[model samples]
Target chain A: MRDGRAISIERVSKKFCRSLRRSMIYGLGDVTRNAFGIRSRSEVLRPEEFWAVDDVSLEIERGETVGLIGPNGSGKTTLLRMLNGIFWPDRGEIQVRGRVGALIAVGAGFHPLLTGRENIYINAAILGMSRSDVDRNFDAIVEFADIGDFLDTPVKHYSSGMYVRLGFAVAAYSEPDIMLVDEVLAVGDRGFQVKCFKRMGELREAGTTFVVVSHNMHTVAGFVDWVALLHDGKLERFDNVFDGVQSYSRLFLGDGDETIEKLTSGGQGVEFRDVTVSSQKLKPGGSFSLSMSCESREALEDVEVDIAIYDTRDPDLYHQATNSAFGQRVDLPAGKSSLEVEIGPFQLHGSFAKVAVAIWTRGRKESIFWWRIPLELLEAPHAAGKNLVPTSFRVKAAE
Target chain B: MPPSDESRQSAEVVVYRPDNSLRRGYFSLWGDIVRELVRNRWLTVQLVKRDVGAFYKQSLLGIVWVVLIPLITVGTFVLLRSSGVVAVGTMSAPYPIFAVLGVAVWQLFAQGLVAGASSLAMGGDMLTRINFSKKSLVIAAMGRTIVSFAVLVVLVAACFVFYGFRGYDYTPTLGLALAPLSLIPLLLLTLGLAFYLALLNSIVRDIATMLSVLVTFLMLLTPVLYERPVVSNDAGGIASALSAITEYNPLYYLVSAPRELVLSGQVADVGGYLIASGFSLGVFLVAIFGFHLTETRIAERV
Candidate 1:
């Protein structure tokens, strides 16, 4: 609608609170403010409030399939919702031209009791398809969904695969100018997912814009022209798919080489100044010293560190942790101080892993600094004692 | 028009920034809601069909429950009146038929409100994940009630034919021809309350629970089973005070007045009934606007 640009999101930001009670109060306040025409000061973070998507500006031209790649809670889904016009930005402008067909979650609006045949019409209509459009594409969608006899059965009785297949079918058939998909594509079995991707590629050929948010690297890498990499509510990079995806993979693996990621939450005055994996090329079973130095404006006492190593490919796949077996306490002087922990004389499964380091105080209950960075774990020829994590961030309150 | 199948995927120009305050101006909200509802009309129909289908699916009685529930309710009253256990005074026709018609109309209002009020909250799964109009869910929740109301209408019609054979004047009159028009007031009143209740239900959740209890309590208090109490006589205690309070209930006008107009062509308390209808309509409009005002924020809370 905007001369081939179906989505134009400029400096968009959305904030969310974790506490349900506070969120409800904030929700009520927002509604009241909306009614009385009052705009709240949103630039500053209120208590328990954090920006989900901060200063993110992205545009999608018609007929383009773009992948949104990021770690969990990095605002990929939030950005997709903004593109779909479901969540209005707190601070910026999102102008989405033409109709948007959003399949953010699996079977988002599908009524389980409705027959697959009936649900297709409803889901299609919800996605902005006219009745005739559904009628024309009805057979094609059913065939694509492959819900033959189940077409007349209530979707509740159908398997989850059938549900997603029908849901995706209706959405794809709706043929919106822009389609927003969030991890929902992964819910369908691999075969159906391939079919969906193939179908989406064909749809893209038809002038439809596609902005997809997914954690699956292979799927994101498949056919997208560009990949927007999100990190902590910010659009870290929007690069050509190949390059963008590589960076996204690095961002995920916390592949800390030449890049420096300052740990933000190390309690205001105290911060994890830098996290260093002292190995240029890490052999999986080889020994390496991992060190983190925290600088505090205040002289912090009894401040221990909590560090974890994770498979960057999968953040949830934590390879190791310092707190669990090797708990150490260190004192940080008023000025900058450092600590080092020896890692790996034993085997590690992944060749690419990252370290999440945090500085905690008050009996390890409070953390002043936390940051994650990428580490390169090379495949070792021998799996012999390579998995050893030498105890302590040996920073020794260095004077 | 559907997009042509030849254009290739184009790159997106996404710019993430802070604080664009001017886009969501309060004035545009109503316009956006109206636009969304219009776009979602078919979604509303589908949801309604889904709801109606779900209500009877896998049940032994199935759609028969639609006719059976009303028959049992009216059947009890018919038995009570026949055995002289309960004297419901006099009506233009048989008391059982009059009572049955009133109960049928009352269920539409009571059940519609109970269901419609909770539609949004009950649809938390869909509401959170989907971008369709919330108004569609509220309207769709009425589908179950509508299905039963249709069955009730047929049953009422059958009663009229049977009574007519017995030489009683239960035949369709000019008033009966206007029955469809007469139902508009009741439907509007119930739907209006539904908009408010559905919105409120999403916020507090207790409203949904409260409504089921409230509907049951109000059903007995309303003149659905018996005639509107004789206010002229000095009826004492609960009967006297309850009659006075019931006089003001919106449901009385919706259920009692409409049934009266259909069955006997009489308006019960013309001024009071007119005022009630007008108030219900006004509330409905206000409730819709209230819903529209808060709908954007609703998804977050639910």
Candidate 2:
């Protein structure tokens, strides 16, 4: 409750060497220099070294949950380690209040030879639980873990799921004021994950501050109060969950300035020059339009256009459309011409979608021009199950 | 598992800063060291329990190895003496009893030092991912060694009882009970040196391989298996040099004082024993303080 700040990191950075042998040698030099009270050259980088976590600053208020989402090796884990005090930052400072529980790695320090019942005490102790605290909650931990018959068996024999379940159970039951979770929830099965999320929600309601690192954007958007997006070890955006996830998806699809290259040859007399979307951002069941310009060398009798929407994260086409299927024909004059397709109020709930547009002759096998465009969408609130369909529900004693 | 109100209010707050040794005053560092040790004492006990249990879990002999390792070393020396391969100078007691007692006392330091030195290297997994008082790892490893040493002491006791019943004119004085107290300096010296070595070993992989060879070489120079060599002051060349080295060697007094206490109910060189104990105490205090200052960096190195 001091200053109402649970965690504060100021201009922190950590450097790591690339070569293993050289890293150890540098460690020796640093240890020797520090032992004699000589300050290390933290300001400068040595050869083969780079900042794993660059200069970054953040402040987290008490009872606030923030999701740290970024691409691989973007310094999310490094930042988490620094917050947990596992690795000391070479520059700047970090201050944390209250008791902390870290799930940096599930089943960290578990002894393979020890039984599940025995390792619970050891793992919990390492996570900062006192003996009496563990003793008081031992039954709850066992029940939460749900590895009923294998409690007496050695942990080495437990399946990977059971192992993760036990590890997460001990840490969750430790009841820390500040919890740091790093990609641990991805290991559990669906049913167990639901239970884990329920437990996390309970903890969140109890005023536990959380810093979760995950790549699942939907989970991040739904669970966190705010989101911090990182790129190349730097904080790119810190905003509400919706905006943060949008930028993350945009980043995943590369910069939006990519020139639309044609996937098929545009024959003479009919060629597409440009394409644009009405709105890049859309809500669930929202209307949007796609417009394209065509440069004609001469008059065209009949033209057919196709629009296909592809999910950025999946391989198959999400939805496709053609003007010919709807028994529509278009006639184009010579010189410059334009065409626009209004597709609307559709059911789409994802971070980003790729739209592919192609123009074809009525009887031709291949389209003359094909272009792909990327669109960002705000996910539907409280989305569940495989499809994102907007619906309303009402009940009054079934009258 | 919801925490009680009192525990929540009393929760600890930790702050991390760069170059902590230079940032914090020396007095504050000392206070931090004390607090860290006291707070993590239970973790040390749990680590020790895990280590000792896991060590013997797969072995067929289990606890017998603790008794067997030192006896095997003593048996090799006893065989050497009987075969006339090497001469062990005259001793006041029977040779097997004499050698076994020397080996037991020596193993307390040698075994503890080896185990303690590898503590950090052996915990590379926990060190990289978890943040706790790392000194607990070294202390816990030494605790496992102490468990083994206790078994050796029982083996030594059984040897004395067997020899006495065999009518070899062996008589144990009450000083045997006080022998363990005299070995306290040896434990201190081993732990102090182990702290420095463990830190170095964590940074440099070669230190561990070098340590085993160095320990064997050091044992030859100390008076563990044979009687303390008597050399006159004017003896020239290697003899005089060896004499000077032995005189300054703290291990000599630390190892011999306890062995003499077990044999004659008295220490032959009380002054040397006191000085060795004082020197060991100084090394332990200074080394542990240095370890506390550098422990936070261990994670990065590992």
Candidate 3:
């Protein structure tokens, strides 16, 4: 409501129908037959209505850097389009305070036949900059983009890297009050990305508000101040950046279960049953104890257990270890058996998998039962509260 | 109210979203049409330039191709007249001169109509990004035709000098000089029909493919290359209806005015042409109004 706030979305929802039949057949014969006559044998398909963005509201203050993070099909892009006024919401409203600049898709306004300079004017006009404004900033934009020799060449001739560089340079220098960036930072090479990150930081300091949506948690963690997580057409969590990241990680972990009773039963010879973790405090890089249980119809010998820890934010397995390599064995009789395991200091900050269970008899080595339990690692002792400083930078005084 | 807990609490903020309000009244609606057209002016200019450029780009004769096509068509018809395959009225000027003027005016109408009809579908990429004035695309196409038509007019003047024909009494009177005035209404009618067909073509692509054949038949129906009297008395009772259609056809008046000015050396039935022009203007306005009503939904349909 305040004058300084740049953008506000209030109770907005959007619905799209599945069928386009009504708009397709436009003739007097069809209209008369459908409107006044008896029903025909051929069935007319009714369109199914689906809500792309459900009732949601948020306010973005001037100069604030906000990030939106969510899984695929989570309506993040839908919300961004509504913010950009590309798609109107079926209900509620959106108010924008100043000139809005969108880098929704890089090179979106470019024409293949037009040269770089022509595209700059056309693209800027499409982004809501008048011709006079583009004229004043033309030199600065070209210089910042650094495509000096290629300025007159057609955009189709430019490399993908050159295209993204020019697009970012034009958008960043527009001095917009609100910028909506949709995962375009991953466009250029590593060095250009670093340069863009630095430029964005400077723009933020000079009072430009940005709403960035990205699947890359590392980029979101480094750049944004606040984050909102959307899932299945609804906002799941909106708060500080770290909490939103945590909620996002949890969604990928599936519903949490203390015991593995819901897992389907009946494996070949060995049946893996349950998993559990015992910890005094769940701090990052801290020690914890784990226990696992399995049942076999017959006694099994030389059984091994494999435990792997993976950062849920990233799908790559970070650490994997097996009990057979460590000289440990499990003994199971006909009905039930239990094994105790222990590990220290979880390294990853987001979500980690605590998978452990018994693997049966040699070559075949089928799993009796396995557990894919997820555990969250909070910031370690001194790094407990809000705004934990990253360990990457060091400041020095001038000589 | 003091700054108590109730007062200090955050106020409920309201966001104002603009409704599709261009859907009301004639002038307000026309304003939207103009705004949409102006927004796409760059695209319009590019399309116009591309069209004119493409006509001359790879041709062996280049720009001369513009004058050559009409001259050849007129020459063939004049040969037909000499062989008794066609009959000519004892007009003041030679038959070639009369036929060539008719071709020039018809070319303007034909190019404008064909280009206008396809303008929307041609700029399909621009339509997806932003909503522009649909009618303006048609108008821009007509503007492109006008440029070429001006070249054709100059060619007609050159023909008069080369053939040693009597100059159509070079008069400074505004009415004689404004002989091209009749084309305005024809342009409007072409633009109106183009808007309606362009929208239709977007939905039913088959219409676009069939349009050229339809246009060819319409050209034969209009008295473009020949005089109306030749076809007025033909057989198949349909000729009477067809003659009435040609006589009342707005484009007949449009083509007749320029022919009257150049061939007969006098002003044609000005009142009749004016009425046709007015009627065409009304069609353009109605077409634009209909286009504005449906444009908002175009994005979804496309």
True contacts kept of each: 0.31, 0.71, 0.11
Query: Considering only N, C-alpha and C atoms within 3 Å, which residue pairs clash in candidate 2?
Result: none
Index of the highest-DockQ prediction: 2
The residue-level lDDT of candidate 3 at A20 comes to 57
Off by over 4 Å in 3: A20-46, A173-177, A198-209, A221-225, A235-239, A255-399, B1-19, B22-182, B202-204, B229-236, B255-267
- What are the per-residue Cα lDDT tens digits for candidate 2 across A1-399? 366678888888888999998898888888877777788887689999999889888888878999998888989988998888888888888988888888677788889999999899999888889999899999989998999999999999999989999999999898888899888878788999999999999998888899999888768877898888887878855666777876676575564333444586366666776666688777777767877688878777677778788766667788887887779887777889888888767676645677777777766554777767676655665453224776679987965
Evaluate candidate 3 and give its CAPRI docking class based on DockQ: incorrect
Model 1 interface CAPRI class: incorrect
DockQ agreement of candidate 3 with the native complex: 0.17
Q: Following a full C-alpha superposition, what root-mean-square deviation does model 2 have from the true structure?
A: 5.2
Candidate 3 chain A weakest lDDT stretch, 10 residues: A34-43
**Which of the two candidates, 1 or 3, achieves a greater TM-score against the reference?**
1
lDDT of 3 by residue, A1-399 (tens): 676677788777765556555446532222223222222112222246567677778888877898988899787887886676555555667876655667665555476666789778766654555566678889978987889899988788899888888888777766666678889888788888887888788777767779999988778877888888888778754556767776776686564433422232336765555555685335665666766566777887765556676654457776787776777765566677776777755655534444443344544356555555556565433231222344677899999
Better of 1 and 3 by lDDT: 1
Tens digit of per-residue lDDT, candidate 1, span B1-302: 35653332343333323222234555665676687678777778877877776677657687687777778888888899789997676778876678778878988998899999988888886666667678888988888887888888888878888888888865456766666676777888788889877876777788988888888788877878888777667667776886787777777876777687788777767787788878878887777776776566667678
Cα miss at A248, model 2 (Å)? 1.7
DockQ of each two-chain model: 0.22, 0.52, 0.17
Tell me the lDDT of model 1 at A4.
65
Which of candidates 1 and 2 is the stronger one according to DockQ?
A: 2
